[model samples]
Target: MLAAEKSKKTRHVLGISGGKDSAALAIYLKQQGRVPEMEYFFADTGVELPEVYSFVEKLESWLGQPIVRLGSGKDFYHHLEMHEGMLPQATRRWCTQEMKLKPLEKFIGDDEAITYIGIRADEFRDGYLSLKSNVKPCYPFITDGLVRRDIFDILRSTVGIPEYYEWRSRSGCFFCFFQRRDEWVGLSERHPELFQKAMEIEEGVNRRFSNLKKPYTWVRGMSLKELIADAEAIKEKSALRKAREKDPRSWQEILISDRQDDENQACLVCSL
Candidate 1:
């Protein structure tokens, strides 16, 4: 009988979520002169924020190589139809699986690969771990004992933080259900067209799936129209939360803390 053939080479892959941590990880790896053969990729959801695309371009220039864009070739609407027009939620995050994870798995195929994740040492979350037996996860930040501050430092010295950080906290689709009410308001203010698109999706879903146990709006208990109607109050409450900060060391620290507060509830694959 012929002996079983084994994989000959291992692929080093890093996924840039267009967020600070993943961006920093790519820069960190480059600076450390490790993983020179690393393959960088971004799983584009096609509906990601404009800032995310711009930030990814900036990071690409810094990395001096193209970050391959992986997509299921089917946009969000196609997946919505596949899921029977039920909008994705925190618990039912079919979007992440269909749009993000499955595409990633398809890209890697059955190849033996080392996928690098950007979860910081301070974070207790286990980022997206593929169940594929041939694909293994490696957390460089955790192994190097790097924390949030270290990530910021890396970005500061490199491509700098993503511009979206000024408004939204995490990187994902413009209509991500994980976004806070204030972030939704930020979307309306910053990119009204995308915000309108999101609202339209919500309205359509609600109209189609009227019998769903819960309303099909992105925000819980309120439609996008209602959320925008109360945008001022949301902004005021966000401002008050900021004012309540006793003694932040710096504005960066405040931003970091704000992100950490929300990341716990965010999708590991999409947000991190």
Candidate 2:
């Protein structure tokens, strides 16, 4: 029997999550002249912060090549409906599965490919572990022993950090449930329209799934309505906590520091 037609050539891909480490990784690889044939992509959730799209465009300019956008072609609302009004949570990450990872896998197909991840050396957290044998992940930062400081330096030396980093620590949809209360407050202040959209999503889900044992909302333990009602109080508590920290860092630095303190690793596909 004729041997199965040879498969397509191996592919090199790097996903830019519009976060520091991932953005830095793309720059780092290009600077180091590694993976010269790398194909960059970003899975657009269609609900991401405006800054994210801008940052991706900046990175594309630096790379001198387009970072392909992959998705189900169905926006967040469509998938939310497909999921039966169940809001995506950290634990029940149907959003990530449907919107991010699946789109990635579909883009790569059955071709043998290397997916570069941006988990830094200092981080003990892991990224998406694909079950597809043909799709393997490589952590260049970890292999090169680069840490958080290295990532920052890489970005500062390039297009600089994404604007959203000024107030938010991670990158994902504007309505990501993983957001800390302070970050949510930042969203309300920086992008009131997007925050309002998120609130509307939560309110809609709550309405559609009223009879469910536990309704789905963006924030746990409270609705977006309650969260925004106490937004000023949340900001005050956050400021006091920052004052107590006694360390001088920009808002971005403080936000990153707080992230480490919480050790709340989010979806690698979305954050890293």
Candidate 3:
């Protein structure tokens, strides 16, 4: 073919994980006039929080460019069934592998590209690293020594932090296994229908795999029903904890502050 001798052009891409840092990175790149042609994208899990979608829309409008939404042809439910009723957990994080990374890889294909990651300088973790030789991961925040405050600054100067942060700690699926008990309570209070859906998934898996060597729930050791049964007590403990804090931040601010470092770090692609 006539085009066989031509080299493929490189592309610039940024993945927005519906969290403050990634959103800030997109804004930071734009502000610096660094990569005007950068292709921004989000790997939609289909069951993402409504606020996540709303934040994505706001970010797209601010950038004046569409953040392409990629997904596997199948939904999370289908994947759960394929996994033989094994609910995704921290150890078995196939959800991220399939729902997030696979779609991104499919989008990039054989193209040589720099995929910008948003890991802050203060965080001692590397974000997602794709095995594809042609796709290189770049940590802009790390290179620039940008920390959490810098992320806040960038967001404040642009589309602002996601509204979901008001309740949940980080961004990802609504029923993300990484969520804390308090966040689950927040979800149940904020969006009962979504919470019920998550509960159903947990209950369904447990029932289908009754003989699973290691039975699992979205929250380990506690079923959603049990969590709900004790929601008031959890809330009371959260209130007491907040009351002891000397930070004078509002209740929501305090909760978010306490939540930021609440869990072991999640996959960057899902929560960065």
Instruction: Residues 1-272, candidate 1: write the lDDT tens digits.
Output: 33334344788999998888889999999998899999999999999999999999999999999899999999899999999998999889999999999999998988899999998898888877889899999999999999888888888888887878877888989998888999999999999999999999999988887887778879889999999999999999998987796555665666766545466677766778
TM-score of each: 0.93, 0.93, 0.93
Tens-digit per-residue lDDT, 115-160, candidate 2: 8988888878878777999989899999999988778788878898
Model 3, range 1-272, lDDT digits (tens) per residue?
34543337778999988888789999999988999889999999999998989999999999999999999989998998888778999999999988999999989988888999888777777777888899898888988998776677677667876777776788889999888899999999999999999999988887887887766889988989999999999999987886786567864455434435542378889888
Q: Which stretches of candidate 1 lie over 4 Å from their true place?
A: 1-7, 211-213, 246-251, 257-261
* Model 1: colliding residue pairs: none
Q: Distance (Å) between predicted and true CA of 188, model 1? A: 0.5
lDDT of each: 0.88, 0.85, 0.85
User: How far off is residue 31 in model 2, in Å?
Assistant: 0.9
